[model samples]
Target: MIVSNVSFGCTKANSAWCVSSKDGHLEAAANRSLSPTGHLIVAVCLGFIGTLGFSNNLLVLALFCRFKVLRSPINLLLVNISVSDLLVCVVGTPFSFAASTQGRWLIGKTGCVWYGFINSCLGTVSLISLAVLSYERYCTMMGTTEADATNYKKIAMGILLSWGYSLLWTLPPLFGWSSYGPEGPGTTCSVNWYAKDANNISYIVCLFIFCLVIPFLVICYCYGKLLYAVKQVSGVNTGMGRTREQRVLLMVVTMVICFLLCWLPYGIVALLATFGKPGLITPEASIIPSLLAKTSTVVNPIIYIFMNKQFYRCFQTFVRCPNPSFTSSFRSTSKTTKPGQKSRKVETNNISIAVASMGRPSTFIQNRTNSNGEQGLSVKGSKPVVSLVAHYNG
Candidate 1:
């Protein structure tokens, strides 16, 4: 049914506005409504999902800020991810939700640009951070604990570069390489795929490849190598089951899988929209991909913090009223590696403790001490070894 506004014609199909004449004011009437039933349902659902994401990311920020131990090099990358996702929750979700309900772009052109830029930046940040996290973990699996701990400078550089990279792709829209305007359901803003021309189409293709495809490939390569190393380590020490290490690895693997599942469909849909024939997907149908993409922000906290036993314990301790034991528990301790023990160094100190809590071998430099009090950097049994052997530099 057509909805009558004082100055314009509105349709339920796309919530599009068309005036009877060009001189008619572009401003939609403040009291005008469109597709009330459909918009209301979409609005409620987006609001709920956005709230869950915002709250989860908020908790992550609070936990990282509250705990001193979490300030380690690897966790700083996590903090970066949380900050990016939190900004998206604060700036992008609400605007998109409201616009979805209103059935059109209510925030005007300037708001649309800001919304698209910020959301695009945060999305890129989230993607790059995940890849960096995976690479860092992979390095930890292959490097000494001391080497991993000392690479704080490198980690910081990586975080900064990620933000820069995000801007590199997102800012071009403002420069005429492409443009940002209303997208799916006309309630959200993204790269204007509708502007299908040589320049805009090229930008879209490059953005997708650089932002999504490359990062995905890097993450897969890192995880694959890390898992292979884990398998080799397991086979070498059949007498001692690395139950704890295996469990931690399992959780880490699950997190990467979740990240892919949450985002891959959205990326696929976006690519299809950009490269495929016109009218390939209805605006209403686009909501599914948008919702799936937002879900990544919510699931991140569960993977990065809540599922981690150490972070949970630290959070519990932080929440308690000040006490002598609580203060003591918060204090950092330095442990020297003893001669002749097997240790697996994790990329981050938090990962070390997380694995320790899981009753597995930790990311410590494990050296074997022989009967004559001589220490040898070697695997205990005759099982085949892998690149992890090169990490024993002590």
Candidate 2:
């Protein structure tokens, strides 16, 4: 309408109307707000993505609640992650989607602050939860069995600390350590990256360091340790163990890649906007990374949980309702034979790994009969072999 007025109607319209139309045109261009079509596009994408994340994460929560056997400690951290993602879908995405369709923020200033705060707070919780999850996996693989029986206690503490650490950084912005406002095309809210004042800069720096940097570092270190442990275990000269080692390495790489893919670009753009000269990062460029960050809510559970064979089995069972028929049993299944020792296998589950009072023994032989009473054992002369099975049936 403004463009048409300037292009044709301005010549014949009243002088006042002509001037007002021109001002509106320039203002819209200067604000760099998305056009109506662009906003509708964002709304559609958010609607689909947000609904998927909401449903999947809600299902994950329900699975934990309905099934007592899946309520293991490590699984609790996963549940916490799903909870944070669910909150993001519920609280953060809906508001953004609504504002996008409206072509501007619908809520007032205080609402923007709360919007930014809740999203950032929950995002930080997810990040911290992933880090905590990685560190816990590292400790478990490193066989830190001293406190194995108290796994639940540690996980409960981890859940508390994740939220507490997230709040430690996010809450400061609400109380003037920094500030929250509309960000990324004026349809979403987050930290005021445009502000270059000392207060805002300091807070952004601290947030970058604590919320993003620290969690990433923790993840890398923990997964790196896991790789090293796998390398050591792979020395027993079995193709199965070597293959498992490679799979774990791939999982670690994928995990790290996902972490970077989701968060790193967002952090980079935030920094550039915060410290760069005016217009160094445009609204168009910044919104892509913002969308990627939002996408983590959907990507996380699919990558971290559903992809796991055991979890998928449980998920299938859970959804099947009346006659859930997946017979799931996880075996730690570490097979090893020392120099001259007979071949041995250690079969345990996540539960055994969690509650085993002693460290894992390298080579132990235990004859076992299957549920059908069929006996099987590795013969004495079998070549030295080792295998480590990592699954989640706790």
Candidate 3:
């Protein structure tokens, strides 16, 4: 049996997405729709998500650009993530918002394909960039030597690899390994998970394994080790060090959980459409995961602002005063050493307070004097990260 909502053609086999020929018959290419109330709700929600994501991420980028202190190599990876999310706000969400407001797929087939491809590309960039950022953080946490924080070349290479890797996975869909079509209430589009043919199923499987699984594993592995490593810090046995380590552990966990909570539902639902029988996911239910995934753009910057000492300080300073030189004054002193030098000690200052917040070891403890009258923190090996940490400690 079939039900009609005006021109919509709904069948029991795939009741969630009703076919509608009124919008130039393009929705017949596999788009679907929602009731008027549902469309209004989605439109309002998209407006909020899009506006907040765009504005917050824009502020983050502005803070980065305004402060030379925030230009460290590690922060570059963070900036890359913000860039990807910001692009999604500008390019991907608007079309869906328009479609939802108008109660149909407004841009037709070509627009649907573009929307799916661009969203996939940008989303993958954010995912892989997070993994890379975690790996870099691990390297920074493990030692102040190789993979040091000031290595611009390495950071640039990681940025390139993220975008290149995303293109590698997303472009194939354009060439017909799989395809793009509407999903969930027909106001948006993505890789056509509903198709049961070998081509579509195989593409979805490969995409699931390579694009989603591997990057998320990399993130979990890096951050998991970070949690363990934080506990093992030389200072963690001490009261202050232990407190700082616990804080770091909480931040690492928060980041991992946010990524999992945001994308996992969408991933699960997409797989259900790929493998389960049609209508296994209702259009209303399907939109929940989509909304959850989009919320990631909003969540990430919030985490950075509230949880990261460096980012928080920078953000605070940026808010209070927008001058670059004023921001640089907090971070301009060079704290590095020439290669082959033994551990040197420096007196703790306002600049050194960030070391404790950054989860540096007991050797790098801050805000108090060490055994020697002159020494506040002891660093064994000399690398560019010493300078970077000096800035980060700001």
Candidate 4:
């Protein structure tokens, strides 16, 4: 009565295998495929975002590898995000662009499965990393013990757990909790939200709860606590401490804002399609949220890496002089200079001129010259001495 791989005709239109129809009978229907000319604008936009994401993540990785100043525990979490973004750019974005441009699944069924798996894996990894970063920031601000701020063990554990959680959630579809297939104009592949059966419904609910809802709640809670902590510090008369706290607050706000803007729409659309009728979200309308999610990979480096003063300095040094060794030499010479104007006046003057040319004061050190001609670079008494050698890889 019903069979797959059935021969209806000699042409390509009759080549599809039988699938379960809405009426519970096996029926043969031609796969719905789109044309290249239909979504040319969408294809171009995806291609542009893909290229930009690749470039931005590459720079983030380069900055992490090149500057020892950026190798802190918190920054390692950022690096984890960058790595995930890089994978998305290389493995998922290219295929997405290609498929969009061709207006069909050009790589066949195998490619579609791989595409869905990689995109799901890397996207989950990025979200988990964001949650970890938020928790780290919270602990730093609210911990009673001083050692909690510098705990390397916590950093290592966070990295492990973030990656493990992502793998745990994303690998289920491959193992058959649900399934991956083409979606939205027949070019892109993802978890089939339209599948309304028991197993598929359970998987979609769990995936949304664990990967999206839980992490979103955790991030919100941590940042909310952090905000309260900052507000409590306002009554204290420490101007410098308040400024530092405010800057950190701003960074965290940006991170959360970007994360919500990119993923929230996609999550809402998926949820609607999963619970409501499959016709709730049309293929053409789905393109906006998919493209929005992809743009997150590009926006991350701008907020996480480029906003930092240390990264800006390191990148500037790298562009002007490609040699890391030379950069180290410059750092060492600046640090070892004697605190007197008689022997180091020329050097001190040169340093001032350089800082002026850059149009920003050095954050690590300040120049102080006494009337008796004693000169040195130093920070405030409460601030720890940031040694150039300590931050240099070599």
Top candidate by TM-score: 3
Please provide TM-scores, in order, for all candidate models, with all chains considered together. 0.75, 0.77, 0.78, 0.75
User: Better model by TM-score, 3 or 4?
Assistant: 3
Q: For residues 178-226, what per-residue lDDT tens digits would candidate 2 score against the true structure?
A: 7676676767878777666688789888999988999999999988887
Clashing pairs in 4: none
Count of backbone clashes for each model?
8, 1, 1, 0
Give the C-alpha lDDT of model 4: 0.64
lDDT of 3 by residue, 273-386 (tens): 767765576777788888888888899888755465566667787678647775454454313322222222333443422231122111333344556765344333211221
lDDT of 4 by residue, 23-97 (tens): 121222222333456568778888888889999889888988986555555677888898999899899888878
Error of 3 at 67 (Å): 0.5
How good is model 4 by TM-score? Answer: 0.75
- Candidate 3's displacement at residue 285, Å, is 1.3
lDDT of 1 by residue, 316-386 (tens): 77677668765554452212222222434433212221121111112333457789997533433222111
Cα lDDT computed for each candidate against the true fold: 0.64, 0.68, 0.68, 0.64
Poorest lDDT segment (10 consecutive residues) of candidate 3 = 353-362
TM-score of 3: 0.78
